[model samples]
Target chain A: MLLNVQNLQAQVEETEKQILKGLNLEVKPGEVHAIMGPNGAGKSTLASVLAGREDYEVTDGSVDFDGEDLLDMDPEERARKGLFLAFQYPVEIPGVSNKLFMQTAVNAMREERGLPELDMFDFDEYAKEKIELLDMRADLLERSVNVGFSGGEKKRNDIFQMALLEPKLCIMDETDSGLDIDALRLVANGVNTLKNDQRSFIIVTHYQRLLDYIKPDHVHVLYNGRIVKSGGFELALELEENGYDEIIKQHQDA
Target chain B: MAKKLSPVAQKARDFYLHEAGKLGDASSGVLKQVRDQAQEAFAEQAFPTAKDEDWQYTKLTGFVQNHFAAVQTSEEVAGKINAYMPSFPVIKLVFVDGNFSESLSDDLNELPDGISLESFADTLSMNNELDKVFAGQDKILAEPFGSLNSMLMRDGFCLQVSANKALELPLYVLHVQTKAGSISSLRNRVVVGENSEITLVERYVSAHEEGAACSNIVTEIDVAKHARVKQVIVQQQNDSSYYFNNQFISQADSSNFNTFFASTGSDTSRHQNHLYMNGEHIENTQNSACIARQSQTVDSRSYTEHNDEHGFSRQLHKFVLDDKAVGVFNGMIRVDQKAQKTDGQMDNKNLILSNTAKMDAKPQLEIYADDVLCSHGSATGQIDENQIFYLQARGINKAAAMQMITKAFLLEPVEDINNADIRKWITDQLEVALAKTHLPKA
Candidate 1:
């Protein structure tokens, strides 16, 4: 298994409001999974916890990634360890040029793998290839990171960043929310290109339309902070047509 | 018995008293009255001790005791421009010991038609109408240092540009204090004609190696209808010097005024900038950044007044305090009753780089107009740890990560500089200042 979460239980600060209650999940290499849910189902909280956001406390859990204690690492450490999260709201870091930021992140990941750093010229040459692959404008690299970018552009930028980092497991949290039709198509195409036997993705989304562009092997219905049912990709088609009411009702009855 | 003055202040006082004999007779009755009143104020206020509020952060006891006198009018410091010239192309004017040095200044023989650059004393003597320009404004001279500069008023530059004339190069005023133990006060008056545009760069530097030196300087800018003026004041005095300066600007109808201040030196420094928008549709943008290290301290106070309707003003100031250094900022924006439809914004951000470093930022807004947008905020905090961690995770070591974060903190305001050349120059200076902090490299 590439990632193993065993009976994870977590809560927010100073309250018994359990966001993740005894959740269990496992994903192996070369597999894609989709987590679908209604509002207040702890979808974002789960993603944030996995990414090591300090606010989420994993009260009782064991997360093992590639034989290492994943919860013991820092957020950046998790990133260096091939855990990539495309934030729902991409952070805006002004004064840091996109090109420089990407190069720094790439070099950091390479350094973790005991590789040499890329000089300015080499980094520029390398970034150009990825920029073109994503069909992103070359001029965007020179501007501040995500500053003054449109919603569609920010999403594209995030995907481009994911491509540059080349992580083993990419967790895209609501990456399709603000994208237009064309932008959504482009983002999906980029993700499709990055898909391979050596990597996997956990795409979290609200609408089933995004799943149409990039199909997932497993679909899990999350309701009230727990997984109510699990099925194949066709389950997404069923949920899209009928909505999430039947799944919630069946889980409550059980 | 004579009050025992510090060796430096004593020499400074002697120098100024000697130079006073050479000054031309007070040109106008108003000038004489103003000068006498200034002398009285200085004698009464004297040099502030540690108790005064304005002088609390910056101690001037040693500077006062030095009693340095003023420099003679004819004294000149040669060959000082080569090392300290601004990185940008500018019309250079050199002043030594508060007196304009024509030989060291750029050529003005073939004037640019309507533009004028001459000595204030000469301007007042040649044109009777100029007397009213400097006529005793007691309100402006009420401050102790303001009165001192007015009384000891020596020759300084007077720049006037005609309507619709936009100079290609920025005017650079280089004030060099070469004489040690001499209290030097330089006063400048600039008048931007109706519909004209200009950029001014004022650099304050010291040539003295050591000893006590104090500079009490004041500049008044008159911006007219539809004119735009950008002023940059770069003060890089010697680490051993003392300086107290004030800048007063009044903007008329539809004019825009932009001011940038960068201070990196001086043991103790105080800078005051007051902007008044007296006509409709006027706008002002003020920016300031200071890097204080070791025992140095910088105190900046600013006031923006909206006296007319439909005016706007925005102010942003940032400080990076390291070592035991202290930085203080007091900014106020006032909207009068008739100043309806006004918009004002003020923000001050401080980055404390050391445990011992201290910063005090107070932003105040008093709005009487009902239909106005006014906001003021002040924040003081250490470097963001998350930002630091993000950089470090990207292969930058802890030290380089901190440097990058600090640079980003200042760059927030530095990037607001409109001119490309000025922006680049300020960035380069910031790099040098960062280097001087002896921050460990990543």
Candidate 2:
């Protein structure tokens, strides 16, 4: 399994408010799992807990990534170990050029893998290929990270970083939010292009629109805090036709 | 009744009196009168203590107790400052141990037409414009350290540019301190004629680090109508050094002036800046950055007065303090009643990297003009954990992320420098200082 979460329980660190109550999931290599849910269903919280955000505390259970305990590592360690999370709201780091930030990140990951670090000239050439692949503005490399970029542009940038890092397991938290139709297609296309038999994706979203572009192998309906129902790809189309109310009601009654 | 003076103040006064007595018959003229008045002010207003409002955040008792003798200048120390000089084409004026070195500096006679750069002492008697140049002496003499500099300063620089002339190369003034436990008093004057342009860079550095050296300096600049002037000052003395500076600038009609000041050295430092807008439609920009660590303290205070209509000014100051270091910033903006349609903005931001670091910032706006648009803001914060995590998620370690953020914070103040070479030089100096800093984890 690429990632395995068994009965994960977490809460907000400051308020002690339980956000994810016994959430369980399993994803194998090359499989795309779509996590669909309504508002306040702990979808984003689950992603945050997996990404090792300090704001959320994992109270119980274990997260295993490629036979190693995922919760024992820091965010950077997890990133070095081939786990990537595309943030819902990309951070704006002013005065730090995107080229420098990415170059540092890339060299750090390279050092972890015992590979030779890429210098500025080599990194610029390497990043230029990905910029062209994503059809992003070349000038974005000279600008500050995410500063003055539109919402759609931030998401595209995150996807561009994902393409550069080439992680084993990618957890995208609502990457389709705040994107127009063309932007949505561009983001979905970028994800589709990166997908292969060796890589896996855990897509968390509110609507089923994004899943249409990047087809998922399995669809799970999340209610309250846990995965209430699990089914095949047809489940996403069913939930899209009849809102999450039906599946949520069935889980509550059961 | 006479006020009691601190040990440092007494030593300075004794040295000045002995020096004046030695001059005897040679010290006679308007300069002598000015020096006498300054001596009186320095005597009355000795070294400021914690009781004074401006000195509240900066404790000077330890500094005032040190017995610093006069600086000793020598021809042998000329080659010590080559490492600090930027690799660029420029006319250089080198000052060693606070005295101008004739052999080390570039030839002043080779200067372009309409531009004059000479030693302050050499031009004192021959130049009749000295009276108008010291027009702001009264206000400067009010401060103890300013008056002390005026009373003891013997050599510095005088730069003048004629009307409608622009210089292609920047004029660089380098001050190198080589003696230990000594004091160097220096004064500089800059006057730019109407419709002219120039760029000036003044740097202060120390070659010796064993004992503390003190540099007390005063600089006055006059910007005529339709003139443009850009100035950059970088102070990177050794850890065991004391730096005190007073800068007075006046702008005429339709003129523009921009200045960038950065200090990342010295155990104790203080900078006082006073800007006067004398005519209408003038624009002014002032930016400052300071990095202090290991019990060092950096204090900066600026007061700007807008006396005419349609004046615009903006000031941004930032400081990065760590390891029990202390930083103080007090900025004041005053718009006169007759200065209508004045737009002024002042902002101060500080980043404290250590648990025990300290910063005191006060931004004050006093506007008597009802129609002016003025605003002042001061903010103090540590590195945001979210920003760190954002970098960490991208595979950067926590320490590297903190250092990157700190560098970015310090670079923002100098981003507006027009000359690329000057900007690069300043950035290079800042990077060297930043590399030596040890930032605690966020």
Candidate 3:
């Protein structure tokens, strides 16, 4: 398995209100899993917990990635361990150029992997290739990180970063939000281009529109801190047509 | 142990007292009023001791004990004045013992229209609307050393740029402390007319034959409507001197003011810059950088007030302290309720290059306007260790990596300077300052 989760439970800081209650899932390599949910569900919490956001406390859980303990690592450490999270809302770091920040992150990951650091020329070549694939403006790389970018531009930048990092497991949290049709197509294209049999992805979304572009091998309905129903891609179409009411009712009946 | 006066300081003090006595009674009624008030204030406010909060970082006892006499007007310093003219040809004003030298000064005949640069004493003698310019402005002149400056000031520079006029060349004023052991106080008043533009460079340096000289100087700038002014203060006094300087600037509507301070001298120095934006649509940019070494100490305090609506201010100060030196920065930004839509940002970053060296940075913001955005932050730390290690791991030696990081820390603020020439000059000086500092281990 590329990612293994067992009896996961998590809570927000200083509060006993559980956000993730005994969530269990597993993903093997090369599989695309879609997690669909309504508002107030544990979709974002699960994504944050896996990505090591400092705010969420994993009260009871065991997350193992490729046989290595995942929960024990820092956010940056998890990033170095081939785990990438495309944040719903990207942070803006002023005075730090995008090129410098991306290069630093890439070099940090490369250093951890025991790979030789890319020289300036080589780094430029790699960055150019990824940026071209994403069809992003090359000038944006010289500007300050995420400063003054539009919502759609920020989302595309997130995917662009993911493409650059080339993580083994990519967790894209609502990457389709705030994006127009054109931006959505470009983002989906970037993801499809980077897809390979050796890597896996966990796509979390509130709407089924994004799943249509990036087909998923399996779909799960997460409701009120738990994944209540699991099925194939057809399940996404069923939920999209009937809404989440039937799934919630069926889970309660069971 | 009694603090002994350096022979040079004694001579400077004698020169100051002699000049003050020669002025015997204040010549002009306005001068008499200002002088009397300043003397009383100076006598009432004892010299700031180490216990004083503002003066705690700087020790002034060694250079303050000797009551130096102010220098009288002299034709003898003309040779000294001509020797130090900057390489670039430009109009120059030489002040010896606070007194201006006309023979050494450039003739104003060739000056552009609507601009006036003359000796303060000459303006006083002519009674050329001096009262209208400085009348009732005694609060700023009443500070301890400021009062001293008012009471003892004999000769200084006075500049007035007419409305809507832009000077083709900069006005360079050199304040030379000629005699050691002399307490010299110089006062300068500059008025930028409405819609006019000008650049003023004030350079302070101790005489070659320096002793324990104390220089207390105050300069006031009044910027009028739609005007632009750039003021650069360069202080490179003798290492054995004690210097206290204050700059008070007031701005009118829609004006822009840029002030830069560069200090790399004096054993103990304190600089106070107070700015008041009294009109709408005014903007102020203030930058200060200091490099201190040995037992030197530099303390800088600034207050920026947004008294009108739609005004903005930005301040950036960087300090590089090494050896047993200390640098202190206190910046305050205040936005009144009437100053709606005001935006203020202040940042003070310090680089401490030694274990014994220290920096104290305090940035405060007080906003009474709900529509205002005011933020102030201060950070004092050594260079980043991780950055240093990363550079060192890349085949660069530890010492070289440290030098690179330290240089970057100092250059960060220098890069904000808009003038290319000034930026290059400051960068070169920063390199020299860093060379004198001890690089930390990676």
Candidate 4:
């Protein structure tokens, strides 16, 4: 297994409300897994916990990535070890140009892997290929990170960043929220281009609209925190046709 | 004997009694009358205390109670500042110990047409033109620090941009302080003629690490009709010293005046800005950044009066305090009755980095005109938890993430500077200062 979570238990730091109760997940290399969920199903909380956001406390869990304890690492360390999380709401970092922010992150990761760091010109040249693949605006390279970008642009920028930092496991949390059809296809296209047999992705999103573009190997329905049911790609179509009411009701009734 | 004088007052009396004559002090003139009146006002006001509403948060006892003497800087010592100057094209006027240093300053012989930049003592002493240039500032002599600067200041710059001429190069006035336990004062004036345009940069720098010196400065700007003046002031001094400067700006009909003031050093630094809009359809932009750390105190005060119709002023001031540092921001916007259709917006944002850091923000708006739009807001907050988590999620370490967010906070105030070199210089200094404060470690 490339990424494994056994009996993950977490709660909100502010209210102490348990969001993820004994959740378990596993992902092998090159597999694309889509985590579907109803409202309050702990999809976003799970992403935050995996990314090591300080707001959520992992009360009990074992997250192992590549035979190493992922829970014992800092967010930056996890990133250096090839773990990436595409935030649902991309942050606005003013005064920091896209070029500088990316260079810092890319070089840090490169240093961890004992690769030569790219200078300004080299980094710009290297990023140009990724930018073109994502079809990002040319001015995005010079503007502040995520500042003044429209909703679609912000989502696409996240994918563009994901492309720049090619991690072993990419977990996108609600990446399809607030995205138009064009933006959705563009983001999905970028993700599809990056998917390879050596890397894996756990895409957490709502709606089956995004699934049509980037096919997933497994589709899991997350109800009330834990993965209540798991199935193949057809599971997403079942949820779409019948709506989450039937499955969630059946789980609650059980 | 007269009643016992306070330490600050005694120092002022010593300046008048012992050091005034040797410094070529003015006497038997209108400037003399102004100086005498300023002395009386200084005696009456003394050094500010907490009782004064403006100085409630800023305590000056440590900075002013100690006696500071006058010291002359050597030519070699003054020339050392050239090494610290960023690579940029501009007219650089270097001042060392309140004295103009020709050896260090750039020559103005091969200059642009309709431009004359000279020392205040050289230009103002020629005629009574000093009365017109320093017109509005003298009325504010009741202000103790302002009066102290007026009483002791001997040399600064007097720039005259002739009518209808536009000079592209930035005129930089660099003040270099190398004396320890010394008191230095500078009064400068600028006159941008009608329909003319110019870029001016006034910088305060301390070359000595343990100087513990005090600098009191006042600048008067006279903007003629249809003239535009863009000024940038960067004050970076030794952490043990004190820096105080007040700028009085008078805007004429349809003129524009914009200034960006960035403060990142000094143990105690305060800058008071007063601008009067005397003309219609005038626009003014004021941007300030106060970064205080390591038991330092940084204060920024702005007072803008819109006295005419169709005038607009936008003010944004940022304060970032870390460690045990303290930051103060007081801004007052007054729109007069005749100033109809005037629009003014003042916003003060503060970021407190540590539990020990403190930030005080007081913004007041007084609009006598019913047809004006004026709004003021002050917000004090720690680093946004969401922003920090967002950066950390991208793999940046916590310290580095805080530094990045703080840099972005400081950048918004000075990013709009038209001169790329100046903006870059300011940004680089802010980064270095932020690192020195160990803000990233937070």
Using lDDT, give the best candidate's number: 2
- Where does candidate 1 stray beyond 4 Å? A1-29, A33-83, A106-143, A146-156, A171-190, A202-254, B1-31, B47-65, B73-80, B120-130, B207-212, B390-401, B438-440
lDDT against the true structure, per candidate, is 0.80, 0.88, 0.77, 0.84
TM-score of chain A of each: 0.96, 0.97, 0.97, 0.97
What docking grade applies to model 2? medium
- lDDT digits (tens) for residues A1-254 of candidate 3: 98999889999976767888888889999899999998778898898889876668998979999889999976666777888887777755444556766776677778888999887788889999998887889887787667798887877887878887888998988888888888888888888988899789999998888888999998998887888889999999998999988877766524
Give the winner by TM-score: 1 or 4. Answer: 4
Cα lDDT over the full model 3: 0.77
Q: In order, how many clashes per candidate?
A: 17, 0, 26, 1
> Higher DockQ: candidate 1 or 2?
2
In candidate 2, which residue pairs clash?
A: none
Report the C-alpha lDDT of model 3 over B1-442, residue by residue, as the tens digit.
2233455544534544455556765655776777666655654553556666666766656655666666564337666776555555557877665667676777866788778777667666676565775663576654667766776776577788989999756687877777776666777788999999887777777765557677787788999999999877777778877788888999999999998887787888888888999999999888888888898888877989999999989888888888899898988998998999998999888888778898878788888989998889888887665454333222234565567556655666665566566567657755765676666543
What TM-scores do the predictions have? 0.78, 0.92, 0.63, 0.91
| Cα lDDT of model 1 by residue, B96-151, tens digit | 87777788889866558889988766764675664566753565676767866776
User: Model 2, A136-230: lDDT tens per residue?
Assistant: 88997899999999999998999999988889999999999989999999999999989999899999999999998999999998888899999
Q: Of the candidates shown, which would achieve the greatest DockQ relative to the real structure?
A: 2
Weakest lDDT window of 10 consecutive positions for candidate 2 chain B: B17-26
Q: What class would a CAPRI assessor give candidate 3's docking? A: incorrect
